[model samples]
Target: MRKISPRLIYFFGALGGLLFGYDTGVISGAILYVKRTLDLTALEEGMVVSSVLLGAMIGAMSIGPLSDKFGRKKMVMFAALIFLIGSLGSAFSPEFITLVLSRIVLGIAVGGASALVPTYLAEVAPAKMRGSLTSLNQLMVMSGILMAYIINYAFSGMAHTVSWRWMLGFAAIPSAILFIGGVFLPESPRYLGRIKKFDEALAVLNMLREPAEAQAELQEMKDADEVELGGFKELFSKFVRPALVIGVGLAIFQQFMGINTVLYYAPTIFKAIGMGDSASLMGTVGLGTVNVIITAWAVRVMETRGRKEWLLIGGVGMAVSLVALAILTNFAATGIMSYVTIVAMAFYLIFFCATWGPIMWTMIGEVFPLAVRGVGVGFSSLVNWGANLLVSLMFPVLLQHFSMPIIFGVFAVMCALASFFVKRYVFETRGRSLEEIEATLRDRANVAEDDSVVAGTTPIAH
Candidate 1:
């Protein structure tokens, strides 16, 4: 195995994340312009905002098998092309339908990249550095958000009608970079192994690992490959049930905490709390800034603190922040309470950035075995985007009837429950090879079986 520079892996992985960030965040700014120019009603506004998520749900659901069959690199390139077309189409969209359609396409690209990129990074990365390298995805995403905010602010006064077009159009630049950058990236070694292209897999592994390690890694992959590959039915079969549960659970929990609601509508939320339009915009920028700073901190702590610990910390923090936010909202009649809400939001952002935001992706990428990784991550991502759609679609309605306090309170309880779920169900994969983790799970299961037999109890399969 030839050893590649860590810098190269980090660069490519971060670029994939940049695409995720740019595509997802760009819409938040563009929707305002789109709604205004089209004279959209509440329903129309919801459609415009939720359309991309609908596309993402479809993309996330379907892209896994495509990535598995076609190779991660090719699928990513295809996604970039989709994003390019979506960006251009959205920028020049003359009608509501066209804009919605364009965003759907962008969502597909975003969804595919979201599922594939972290899996690709985790597969190629050395075990010791995997957390840090994979966290680049989140960092790039936050960077993309920050960049979008900056771009929107810079173009804020440039003929309001066209400014949104420019915002949507700007994504093309990063899409092009991702397309070009992806060309040079090697195919995932696991994908190669799954296809029985052992020599090619070995060569790719050699690039990422020491020669001795590469040889052993190849053997381990081959042993694991004995399991069935592909097909939706395979995902539910006895052997793969545990993996399916973890993947899907992670996906749903990641979104049910209401992170996207905060990300997609931070400006509006701040405005509702008494800030002027300009101050609200600045507040949104502050949210993005905090997101980026804490995401970087997550990358650093990921390896040190481990995934499970960070998740616990983040979940606790998120719950606390949300509760505080709810309290502030309940007291909004007092003008000073707005500042309290801002502080609560900042804390929420910090918790999310440091824990759930990055760790969720990293855990999803790591938990699945290579044999079923594509379907596992794909389905998980599908659930993720699906949950995102639900949140985006209902946030306006929830805000209208329940008040911010009730809405955020619901999210806080959900987050706290997620933390408990993690402690009970999530296994630690830190500092271990994929094969090693798989072996441990198998061993643990076997031990339970033996103990069950001796005690005359039924052993849980998972």
Candidate 2:
């Protein structure tokens, strides 16, 4: 048998993210028609969109244990099956409630993919290449979003009812691809090591790395496995607390910063600003194009620039872009401002896709100790999706009650705060092995304990 290329492994592993992006993003276009067809009130429309998030929270919470018990590869395959079922169910829904339910099922798969893909990629990739290779998940996600935008545009010419169905049903194709491709992908060597399948883990590492490097990495994995698999107890313990804080903080900051408003409602925003349906959807395609381009660029440069720096730089750009958007909407809400909205959105995506967008996922996958990596990443994803749900459900409500300036201004403030969050908490993970990152967390935890003792206070244990 011909040896499989590592690139093929990365491609299949990341395909879940493509499904994640498509299922989440296709709604941005399909909601236009779904609202009209269902005569959805703003609250109902919000439900239709955010119900997926409800399922995502469930999936995120459950996936860690399931993936731990069964392995990452199996859970990924399971998610693909859910994607297929949900896509068909969504496309053929006969009523509003059914459509919402279908999307909830889809959200479960989305949530699982969101947590699993980054973790899987991070585990499979070598530390030297980990940042970029792990970032491939984000790239596939952007590609999926871009594909959804194009499909939405293509189907925009059809009758409203039919177009939205096609827009949603297109997801089945990629889900099928992911399912088929996952069959050939190797299991994560780290996971195999964790399970004490040393021979299997070494076999996989050998396939992916130079002989000397593979042996060394396998030894590192074996050493890391000295700690038993962690549960909630270990996760909340003092030793792991800082990594938890960083992962959860990144998750919250990434979502509350308002990139999704642009992604989920770009067409709606343009439509509100007086663009027609075709023009509005076209505007989103432009945003999606920018998203894919910048994210691909970010992947190439991720190692050299490092996570923390790009995050800070992107934060400034995002804040400025949101501020410009607030001003633009306040002073010139229509006509040429429609074009300006697209431009502002493009800048926001450039900053986000290149920095927080990929890095958030990448670091969450990196920050946790290997013993609890799956659960740590899953909990972070749960928070991320929860923030996503709140923002998604509340965005339309906010639009109803507030002016665009107020909404965007609020988002700008959050973006600035995100920069502060990064500076205060995030450490550089560039070019570091996962074990090395975990060791730093251990060192920080120990220092905190020492300081507490010196200060004459017993450290509170989690």
Question: Candidate 1: how large is its RMSD?
Answer: 2.5
Query: Candidate 1 regions off by >4 Å?
Result: 1-5, 223-228, 333-336, 444-462
Off by over 4 Å in 2: 459-462
The model with the greatest lDDT is 2
- Per-candidate TM-scores read 0.93, 0.97
* Count of backbone collisions within predicted model 2: 0
Cα miss at 207, model 1 (Å)?
A: 2.5
Task: Give the per-residue lDDT of model 2 (tens digit) for 1-462.
Answer: 235787788889899999999888989999999998889999999999899899998888788557877799899989999999999999999889999999999999999999999999999899998899888989989999999999999999999878899999889898888899878877888889888998888888877899899999988877763867778888889988888999899999899899876888888998888889998889889889889999999889989987889899989999999999888888756667668777887898899999999999999998888888888988999999999999989999999899999999999999999999999988888889999998898888889988999999998663
Candidate 1 displacement at residue 305 in angstroms = 2.1
lDDT score, candidate 2 = 0.89
